[model samples]
Target chain A: MESTYLFLTTVTIQSSMAVLFATLGEIVTEKSGILNLGVEGMMLMGAMSSFAASLYFKNPWLGVTCGLITGAFFALIHAFFTIGLKANQVICGLSLTIFGMGLSSFLGRFLIGKTGTRFLIWHVPILNKIPLVGPILFNQTPLVYLSYIFVPLIWVLLYKTNIGLSLRAVGENPTAADVTGISVVRYRYLATIFGGMMAGLGGSYLSLFYTPGWKENMTAGQGWIAIAMVIFSTWNPFRAVIGSLMFGGINALQYYFQASGITIIPNYILMMLPYIFTLVVLFLINQTEGAKRKLGAPASLGVAFEREL
Target chain B: MIEIKVKQRIAYPKITKFFTPFFALFFALLFGAGLFKWVGVDPLKAYKIMLSGAFGNFYNFSEVIVRGIPLILSGLSVGLAAKMMLWNIGCEGQIVMGGVGATAIALFASPYLPNYLVIPAMIFSGFIAGALWIFIPAIFKAKWNVSEIISTLMLNYIAIIWMEHLYFGPWRDPEGRGFPGSAIFPDAAWFPRYLGTRIHLGIFIVFIVTILIYILLNFTKLGYEIKVIGESELAARYANIKVTRNIFIVLMISGGIAGLAGVGEVAGVYHRLQQGLSSGYGYAGIIVAWLGRLNPWGILSVGIIFAGFMVGGDALQLNLQLPSSLSLVLEGALLFLVLAGEILPKYKISISWKKLSKS
Candidate 1:
């Protein structure tokens, strides 16, 4: 029972970091009132690029940096589209996603079955002696600890600072914010690029620490799960962490359940849980009368701000 | 630092419309060539091979049509919904369900029923199944104002999983050889072909769907109402058009048509219900719809062009050892460039005079 507990805990946190990073990134972007639906695309680009880069550079950290750039690069196109061209955000985002998927698949062709330099495991020096919690909580990769710090750091950044307030103001009421001297375009671009970069890191995590081998669409629906996590958390960075862990637990539970030899429920049906859970939660939150969703959603989330020059 | 301003065009020259698509195509090809170069393949050689493979001979044209048949249905599904401003990215899900429906009819009812009844029944069941798949998302969008984007996207994953559950469990072939696919469909259920080629009766079906969509969008009140709704939902309500009902109808039409693509694939192409039934036709349909600008004839043309990409991509795999995913890259580049180019005709750009003062 103790072993099972440790197994589930370690797996949960490991899986959670990828989604946690993505959700946090999206939260920041949405806070600035830019809705980016290209998380999956950006993540895929990040995953493939980082894996390939790590393979070439022989350093997982450098590969992760490359992923950050690649993800931001994809988001740059999206930024140019919605911010510069004033194109419909939904269409441009969808295009960005498809572009990412295609590019990743095309580029990842030779990288299949290839492993890369991975984030090394570490245990807290003195904390490693603690009972059940020690192995689960204190013993983890560096990135996992970084993800733990991000929750509070982002929470404070989003809630405590003037920049956060201005970002929120821009997303909530761009015209009013514009009158008050905040540049909506700049804030949105920065927020979106940051979001894209985090999503890339999320993908980099998948390639470098979580799985450490490249395959076609290795990120699968995790990017979507991260997006769903953003909504499920009601745009709170801390809440987003909890949501990611929950979804991550569910993902890890699938493997656990399979290994335990449960015969009644099949694998494919188990696979449906995450998506169905997302749908149910989205429906519940978006019922229009839900107070939580109302408070969390940016006022002008997907609306294009056409500045009068 | 020069500032740019956009002015909405009141009226555009007819010639500009004709040139925009060609320009988009030219740029898309250029972008694709650059991608090829990055992948260590010669751009000119790859393009030459691709063009030849896609349009080399009568056999290649037939293959293109075979591949295009589903894309037309998938494109129309999206094109119709896009007209009503309903973003139905669930065409992939709808297609999968349609395949299930058609496969059930083909496998179960084909032997029991007359040949004439079976084919039509499969088609009808496929449409109904597809429509049913999108029903919940439609209601949520119409009544509750839920974002159909995530809902529809989620449904795609669910549908694929559901399909996998069946094939891997109950639907797995038991008799002939312990395969993953269902039993080969009965002869009576097969889509008829012409001139000993793989091109099925879907050729005629494609033409019919294209004509119907064109007429529906161009000559019908529903089409006009869809246009109004897309342009402005408040304006549509003011015009006394039933926004909720139109929303539902649009979804049903979109889902039903997309399902037919599944039917064409199963009854025509694969001849069985199995894994890999949808090769991203659902998602690719969106690209086709956008590429075609929601025009029926344009959808048909774009469908064929995309189909050519698929066929040529296969040829690339066989001959040059290039990955089939190159086609996906090409498609993405085309969609991106086309989307960029689409703005030019509608809006005019001008240089701001007092750029220095603004800074």
Candidate 2:
């Protein structure tokens, strides 16, 4: 019984790490004033690319790299349209998503019926031997540990550094940032691309480790969930960790409950818990004035910036 | 060449406005051709197959119009909502609920009512369901300033799950032999088909709705209010337009129109509630709305064009051994190009010597 509980807990943590990584990555992108609806497309592409590369190269790390690169490639297209051509951000983002979905599905049709190379969890010798906290905290796949590390790292990059300051400045008031000699467009382009890469890596983790296989539309609407996580976290990476984990936990609980035959609650309602939770969070956050002030987004987040004549 | 620099400063004639979209379309086609070529297919042959497939036979051509009906309604929904500066992304959810409401009436209520009464009731129910689905987010935005984009999008998942639950559980047809869907509606509940084709009276309804929306938007006071609000909320408020009420009204209308699209699909085409009923018509409507520049008449033209692509895509899959997703690729490319086209008209490009040298 204890072993079963430990195994279930491990699965939940792993799944949560995957969601947390993706959501945290999206939070950074939204903070930079670029709303990337293409995360779903990016994740799909990443999943396929990583799975394909891992099968070919026989190395999961290489697969992760391929996934990140694939995601960055799509983001480049988004950046060109929104940053270079000065298109509507939301429309451009959605187009990227549609394009990504179509392209990935087309690719996957050919790739269907093929099994992906599986990955196993590796642990450090000393860290693996440590007591209760160490197993929970330290003993995870390298990708999972990387996700935990990214939270504080992203926080520092978004709040403490000069580049971070400029990113926020550009998001809030691009004209002001441009006047101060910062390249607002350039920063936004880079930030969006970086965020896209992170989202891609997060997706690759699904195929490479989480489920260790490929399925059509497998990421499902998790990409949208990641987008909602940004709002739930109030645009903070640290809080996004908690929000995404809770969502991941709810998702995992549905599966466990279904398997356990505790059938009082309908599975569909349980499946919908994350989205319901997102709506509730939006309500709560919007209601609180203090939360609104602290978590309020940049003034010019979605507005397209053009230099004044 | 005659030196044309005779004291007059000539302004470029906004040629970019017309040329940019052409260029973007050209490049998109080029990219698509490259993709096809990489797969060892001749680009021209593929295009020929796609075009001929969509319009090859009389039967195929009529199918395009049948598909265009829903596209027009959903396009009108997005176009109308955009005029009020509301991004109604939850059209997918609204469409689903619309189908649910319309189907419910067709299954349960149509038997008890007269034919004339039943048809209108289904449509009215669909509109109400759609409006109610979107009402929550609209109200949240109006009262608490929550982001409608997020709310509407999140609601889409809820709507889809709800549909799946109904189809897979309680509403599952007793005679379906384990298939996940409701039973077909009675013939009285179905829309009237056109002469010797699957095309239904819904096409006529779309045409009428298009005309009505056009008149409403261009000639009515409510239309003027929407235009004013879209241009500037502060200015509209100062002009006593009652921005909140206008927002709510526009969103409800938008959701209702979107719902009508779902009703048309369920009652006219499928005659039964199936999982594949939507096939992304709602999202495609967004592209149609933008391509039409939010003009109702424009939506009609763009809607037909979009439906042609869908039919052509189906053809490409069957005949050319190409992926059907090619249509989506084309649509995405068209959206990118059209938006870029809109932007080019507002700005003039100049080649400055200093900037050129710096580069």
Error of 2 at B272 (Å): 0.8
For every model shown, what is its TM-score relative to the native structure?
Answer: 0.95, 0.93
TM-score for candidate 2: 0.93
lDDT score of residue B94 within candidate 1: 94
- The CAPRI-style docking tier of model 2 reads medium
Give Cα distance to truth, residue B244, candidate 1, Å.
1.9
Interface RMSD of each: 1.4, 1.6
lDDT of 1 by residue, A103-218 (tens): 89888888988877888898888787787777887899988888878889989989999999999999898999999999999999999999999999999999998988787788
User: For model 1, what is the alpha-carbon lDDT of residue B337?
Assistant: 75
lDDT by residue (A1-309, candidate 2, tens digit) is 766566566667787765676777777777778777888878888888888888889888899999999988888888888877778788887888777777777776766766666667767678766776566666678887787678899999999999889888898889999999999888888888887898788779988888777776778777877877787788788888888778767776787888888877789998778788888878887887455656757777777777875
lDDT value, residue A172 of candidate 1? 92
Clashing pairs counted in every model:
0, 0
**Which model scores highest in TM-score?**
1
**DockQ of candidate 2 relative to the true structure:** 0.64
